[model samples]
Target: MAHLLFRLRHVTEEEAAEVRALLDEQGFDVYETQAGFFRLGVDAIWLADTRQREAAEAALDTYQQARLARERDAFEQARARGEAPTLWKRFLAHPVQVALTLVAVVVIALLTLLPFLGLATP
Candidate 1:
C-alpha cells in the first residue's frame, strides 16, 4: 500500500521542489498526486514503499525544522531592515483598501451588536 508522505495544500512551489529533490537524493520511491480539475481530489506526495515510511518521516521532520529556522531568521532580518511589510506599512501603501476594510468591520460590528443593545435598552 502506498503511504502518504506529505500533503501539498498551501505548500510553496520552492518547498515542494526541495522536498522532491530531497526524496530523490535519498533514493525513496516517491510520487506526487495533483488536485485534479475541480480541486476536490488529493494533492500529496506518496511513498511507494511503506517500509520506508519511518525513514521518510524522519527526513521530512528534519527538513521542516531547518526550513522553519531559516525562514524565521530571514523574516527577522527583513524586519530589522524595514523590508518586512508591517500593518502600518500595508495601510500606508493602500489607504483606500484600509479605509474600506475598517468601514466594513465597523458596519459588521454595529449590525452584530444592535440587537443586543436594543434588548438591554428595553
Candidate 2:
C-alpha cells in the first residue's frame, strides 16, 4: 500500500520541484496526486513502497532542515540590509490600504463587542 510522503498544498513551485528531485535521487518509488476541480483530493507525494517510508522520511527531514537554515540565513541578511518587510514598511508603501484595513478591523471589533458591552451596562 502506498503511504503519503509529503503534502504539496501551500508549497511553492520551487520547493515542490526540489522535493521531487530529492525523492528521485534517493531512488524512492513515488507518485504525485493533485487536488481536482473541487479540491476534494489531496495534493501530495506518495511512496509506492511502504517499506521505504522511514528512509524517505529521513531524507525529507534532512532536506527540510537545510532549506530552513538557508531561508533563515537569507531572511537575516535581508533584515541586516533593512530590506525585510515590516508593518511600517507596508503602511508606508500603501497608506490608504493600511488605513482602510485598520478601519475595517476597528469596525469589526466594535461590532463584535457592542452586544457584550450593552449587557454589561444593565
Candidate 3:
C-alpha cells in the first residue's frame, strides 16, 4: 500500500529550498508544490524500498533543534534589552563612537611601526 510519509509547510521559498536540499542529501526523491500563501508538499516522502526514514528524520530533527536554540537565545537577548532596540540603534548611540573605535584600532598598528619610524616617545 502507498503511504503518506511526511508533509511540511514552509513559510518562505528559501526555507522550502533548504528543506528540499536536506531531503535530497538523504537520497530521497524529494518534490514540493506551492499552496496558498505557503509551500506545502511531500518535502521528503520516503520510499518503502529505500528504507531511510530514520536517517531523514534524524537530519530534520537536528535542523529544527538548532533553529530552536538560535531563536531562544535571540529571544532572551531581546527580553533583556526591554525595548528601543535594533543593532543599528546600539551602534549609533554614542557620537564619535564609530570614528573613535576605528582610531583606537589604528593606534595599535601605528605603535608596531613607531620604533622603526623613530616616532616612539623616548
Q: What TM-score, over all chains together, does every model reach?
A: 0.86, 0.91, 0.45
Report every candidate's CA lDDT.
0.96, 0.98, 0.63
Write model 1 residue lDDT over 29-67, tens digit each, in one string.
999999999998789999999999999999999999999
* Predicted model with the maximum TM-score: 2
Error of 1 at 107 (Å): 2.8
Mark the regions of model 1 whose C-alpha exceeds 4 Å error after superposition. none
Candidate 2 residue pairs in backbone clash: none
- Residue 55 error, candidate 3, Å: 0.9
Candidates by TM-score, descending order = 2, 1, 3
lDDT of 3 at 84: 44
Q: Which of candidates 1 and 2 is the stronger one according to TM-score?
A: 2
Q: Per-residue CA lDDT of candidate 3, range 11-118, in tens?
A: 456555666677777676444433444534344344354356666667778877887798788988887987545666766786488677879989988898888889
- In terms of lDDT, which candidate is strongest? 2
Clashes of each: 0, 0, 0
Error of 3 at 61 (Å): 0.7
Give the clashing pairs for model 1: none
lDDT of 3 at 35: 49
